[model samples]
Target: MVHHTMATSTTRASKASSKINPMNLRLLRFLSTALIVGTLVACSTTPLPPASPPPASSTPPAVGAVPGDTAPLPPPLAQAKSRWVPVRWAELPGFSTDALHEAWNAWVKGCERPAPAFAPLCGEVRRLSIASPEEQRAWMVSRMQPYRIESLDGNAEGLLTGYYEPLMDAARVPGNGFNVPLYRTPAGLGERKPWYTRQQIDTLPEAQAALQGRAIAWLRDPVDALVLHIQGSGRLRVTEPDGSQRLVRVAFAGTNDHPYQSVGRWLLDQGLVRDATWPGIKAWIAANPQRVNELLWSNPRYVFFREEPLDGLDAAFGPRGAQGVALTPGRSIAVDRQSIPYGTPVWLASAGPTAQLGRLVMAQDTGSAIVGAVRADYFTGWGPEAGDVAGRLKQGLRLWALWPRQP
Candidate 1:
């Protein structure tokens, strides 16, 4: 669970220009003469009669105009959520040393549903998948412009937190030690704006009845189940009724719509714990087992999940992020969409007790807690090591957006 809320090179145009035929050259010369005559005549104040439209060409330009005649489109205006100040490549920390090749996989994944502004560059990005770090670096420097990301007030500093997919054992049917239920979206879930609070789902018969027969899997520990809920996704090793086993993923489907109240903050406010990390919480739970229900009920928000098979290449990546692509571990990050558009390539720099990172990442997801112009939630992948990193990483951060340069 998150502690705090928080490409390409080209010369395609030049290559196409070099292939112009003699016939096209003569047509261009004639058009240039016509343009000169029209410009001279336009000096008169009198309005000229509209001329008959010229015959349309059989082969239209790939771009909206005659390819060579069109000027490059300027970069988009600053996003409302953040102010982007143009900066030189030299200003980016670790620009000369970051392994650009390490980030290419995520770039390819992003091309599946790229933003309109980024759609044109996807081909070059895919071609560079096997490119050496130096070549990729050079391509980026030539093709993209870096901009220092800041808040509307020009605050360049922000907070960074971490999140990871949880992994745990589960049972197809409730029995033995696996009793805590992880459910699919309950019937009538959409009938009410806020379906049911966590406490209500636990104690109210009507709420419980609504969720009857919806459990997808039963986990051994309630805390482990809660971790899945908080993380919004997880992988489960399931023991079937027939004594067979399979690994499956449970992805976020919907929420109860209640506001999320941080359980850690609740403990802090009650003077019950000084450390609110997952380990600390588990330690506290070990000492005060009877109060587990009280601790969980502190937050009314509840999350439901959908089961997906873990197979083939899908097993190699995390769940689909908000950008609708499988997340690349250590390469995907959740950001405020208002601050940075989805599928944008970003330069991330952070140094803290838990980690010191300077690399490239993609903006592919978002979260309720991840709000702010410069704030981000790093996706640490799955399993125990990832959880350890996600549980403790909350530190200072800086970001730069790497966008395509003008044609």
Candidate 2:
């Protein structure tokens, strides 16, 4: 699954000159978080302590509680549950205006491993590459149906976020300020149920013993390393023990199987930082270095990685997504597998603190947080600029899945 991390900054207009260069590759990490409107709003605003859990009450208990119990069940969502509704292409907000040719690149990638339903249409999809936008639109119109996704109670809007690969400096040996080690998945991981939590991995001797001789690379900043863990992948500019430098990707290998707890949510609950974006989180860490371990242990989930060479064509494309295709920057989205099947084409529209976006995106990935029918996690690609955009993009979204018509 393609997981995405949430961003809190407002989106800025992208420069027209910005383009992806295969030779100049950047590392990206795909991390997914299950964020709701409350979390999104909390991340972007001043940090406030979560409402106190109800104080002990002397009164009798309400439904779902024992006679003396005061803890309450969480309230139901304010928005309706998720569902899908059929709609016409004409109803799509920016259907005709999008540059389908650009999206066609993503479609072609998906065709490499098309779903069973779409397998037969791959040839026609390829042949139409040379066709005009109007022709492509016509072909889609003729063969596909657009379904407007909604919540069970018919709420059409949902949250939109983004994630990207992060690039950082590293070393082969643990010295010269590169102290934190990124580990490969340990042997016999299969035998363990929900391996060590981040705290145990960091502090326990047995947990540390399993990782001995398994350091993939050593990093300077523990927070940077944690960011890599959260994203599930990252590019490291490694200074080898022999004094040579090379770029390599640390792709997701395995995890500790612990449930992911949002550190942002932890900070919000603690009333520490006002903004929980990476920048804000980093700021809090810098000012309170002593509390670093305390903060790191807040999230129990731990991710392991395997080194992958970033050379040739691999440098140009992203890590293979859940669809088994190299993700097209800005064109790939991670959705809930249950809501939108992999390889489906979708029209995405959103406007919020982040920039406005309306275009064609392929459902080449899935995320833990992308649960509802209308939810999506847009891929922002790699490098610092992509990270900037990824960290800030939280918006209201609408989606229409374009599915092949039944024969």
Q: lDDT of each model, Cα atoms only?
A: 0.73, 0.70
Task: Give per-residue CA lDDT, model 2, range 295-389, as digits (tens).
Answer: 88988888889999876446555667889887777788888877778898988877654555667889998666667867788777777766776
lDDT of each residue in 140-230, candidate 1, tens digit only: 8778877889999888888777777777888999989889999999988888988788889999999989999999999998778777877
For lDDT, the strongest prediction is 1
Residue 15 lDDT (model 1) = 12
lDDT, residue 170, model 2? 91
- Total clashing residue pairs per candidate? 3, 11
* Error in Å for residue 354 of model 2: 1.8
